[model samples]
Target chain A: MTLQSSPRAFDPSGTEEFAHWLDGVRAWAGTAAPDMSGWRSGAALDLLALPVARGEGGAGAGFLATCRAFETAGEGAVLSGNNVLGGFLFAMSAHLWACQEPLLAFGTDEQRAAYLPDMMAGKVCGAFGATEDGAGSDVMSMRTRAVRTDTEGWCLNGVKTFVTNAPTADLFLVLARTSEHDSYGSLSAFLVPRSSPGLSVGSATEIVGPAGARTAVVRLADVTVGEQACLGGEGAGFAVLMHAMRHERAFILAPAVGLMAGMLRRTVEHARRRSQFGRPIATYDAVRERLVDAALHLAAAQDVLRATAGSADLDELDQARAALTKLHVSREFNALSNRLADVYGGYAMMPDTGIPQLIHDALASRFYSGTDDMQTKIIAEGLGL
Target chain B: MTVDDGVLTVIREAVHKAAPAFDGDDETQLITQQVLDSLAVLKVASRLENQLGVPIRDAELLPRNFASISAMRAFLATKGC
Candidate 1:
């Protein structure tokens, strides 16, 4: 798995920006994983400083740039067995910026100006606190309470599960029950700062892939927030979330396109180098078919992703596009990874071969940015079925 | 035409176009295709707004609104059609 810098037509710089970023991160993950339990904190800070914005061709730089970044992350993992948490963070931050229209349409100016900068800079990580133990996809069923304090401020109370970067998060856009039970209007989004009293994060939850990608339980016990903390007005949280989701889906899937490309390249290269029956395995028809299938899937996924990203401003159309893209890319990654694992034979089962890591990373895609099942359902209900 | 009927027609068509992206042929199939997911709902809302020239507020774009053509027409009618 000697990772030579390869040129990609998609990335003119050949992912030099991301390559340098990974080198530093790999060093940290290798040398510091043991001593730095708080390494995530530093990673968070570094992630904020990284030049992954639209200005430096980073966040809000559009889907092509994001796709390149994801591809680079995939390459780093296959070649070096390094995690791409920063890639995820970069994509998420850019996503927030890319879908600013709906947020600006609904969010107050002060709220936008105050949070957008930090979020873009990565100094302040944002979490979508919509999922609960009881309500995963049914966001309307969330029970987190947001009662008004005596001082005309808001206080949030409830447990939020599966919140990424929870403990390291500087601010949380929390959805809480504002009105009453099962009432759509009752739900509201509040910006709860980590420093706020009574706002605490529980222990980090473990996932199969992205071990250091910190996901934690967020517990708010009467955590009070000022008037500015409220997003939109009473019962506008759902709208805010829907808007954010459009952005999340588009940006998140951008990287997935790249991930598959990376996997395809690796599998092809491996086949070319590994010998079987006194010749390169790449000569075999079966191996060629697998590569071709992966390439086709990658092509389809990339097409859908570009279309989705191009139509980012087209309202709900973007949502449908994002759902479609995410579904295609995630499923494609799942299938491609399995094929690569089979090609690698017993080597895939060992940590030393890097195939296992690639598989783990691919597994995360199916579950991230909402599950494939969730994406299908969105597409289905949109048809009025 | 009342504002409601026009809106309802637009909503129905958009939902119809988006529905085929899902699995079932009719509503009674009890099978959800990929098009019914959250992403598809967003597309339906967009198509409704684009085709019908009526702004369907994010809050109003719920699963119930797109339950069926008849349901959508009725919902539009009640919204000051």
Candidate 2:
């Protein structure tokens, strides 16, 4: 007997066009090579442009549609051997959520005209340079400096680590300290081209899951750009980052939901086929309970992500809800992955089963887009606690 | 934007609730004085949104708008709250 997993139902508009677009995404994922060249050849970067306005060289698919695209890509990645495509997909999504969205939301007319077209068309790739060795959740502590120069712009000097897509990106949205005072208002965001003098990208950092993500360290030594490169104005980096993170933290788990859904479907099929104690394991209450729990978890996570992404505004309340959503979804994804792994027992450790890769991806989700503790703090502040 | 006493009272209450540790006067600098951090400002914004029935836009969430109770009152007056 075949146990079939249903397609995702929260299409926002519930239109045939949207479903077709998702099917196309799934088809690409099924066949695309798990590398940068494959992404470009498949026109996958155009899919990341979904949230930009139509006039801005994008499909204008809105945030929920973009989340759905990520979800579909996630399921496709899992079904196509997550160990190879997981990290690569994550890097692309990070570009969408962290780099592209902020530029779309806050870029000046000139900046948008200069970059969005090629970025959306997949001709150019972008990366976010925010995290530093000394700074992670406490972003204000970053030591990257953007000193005002006598030339037409500012001189930047510092290093950013754990930057996704750093190795292959053509442009970087970097956050630097522009003020002497240690305040939120001290930082600023800049659009620095990778070809800038005194800029360098180190080798990719090997991570547990998402093997091809190409996370690397970026270094800037006396790199300079025109004043026009400053995004959202000087001293607005904190606000810019917060605005981008509100969207990211809310829907970052969409892919995880897809991954969990795919993993659960696979586990159920295995349970039905793999017999133990002279009967199919699917007949056992313990195995069925694990499957049921994973389904419940996936359902709750999907609902939370949908509710948070459904909103068009990024107000204070929405910011709080985004944090709560990230917190709950990441934790649930991790727990559900472990429970699903139990059904596989020793085979769960095998790389070919893809369970280990999913488990590792689940573990990594907790740390990205701010950790669980940071989310709790944001939620608490939202409650005025 | 001259604010009425009622509006000032509501703003002050929201500010106090957001930063209970702050015991300064209405003219004191909330952000510069570090009485309200970024998260506390968000809390104050949320409270003001509920109390005043006006949605605060992202542009108005700047530190200048929430520097003090007097500042918040002026900002709210502009919002027609």
lDDT of 2 by residue, A223-250 (tens): 9899999988887787678877877788
RMSD of each: 8.1, 4.5
Residue A201, candidate 1: Cα error in Å is: 0.9
Task: Judge candidate 1 at residue A12 and give its lDDT.
Answer: 26
Write candidate 1's Cα lDDT for B45-78 as tens digits. Answer: 6776556556676556544555555556666666
lDDT agreement of model 2 with the native: 0.79
lDDT of 1 at A11: 42
- The TM-score that candidate 2 achieves is 0.91
DockQ (C-alpha based) per candidate is 0.11, 0.37
Worst 10 residues of 2 chain A by lDDT: A1-10
Q: Give the poorly placed runs of model 2, Cα more than 4 Å off.
A: A1-12, A41-45, A313-317, B21-27, B57-60
Q: What value does the interface RMSD of model 2 take?
A: 2.3
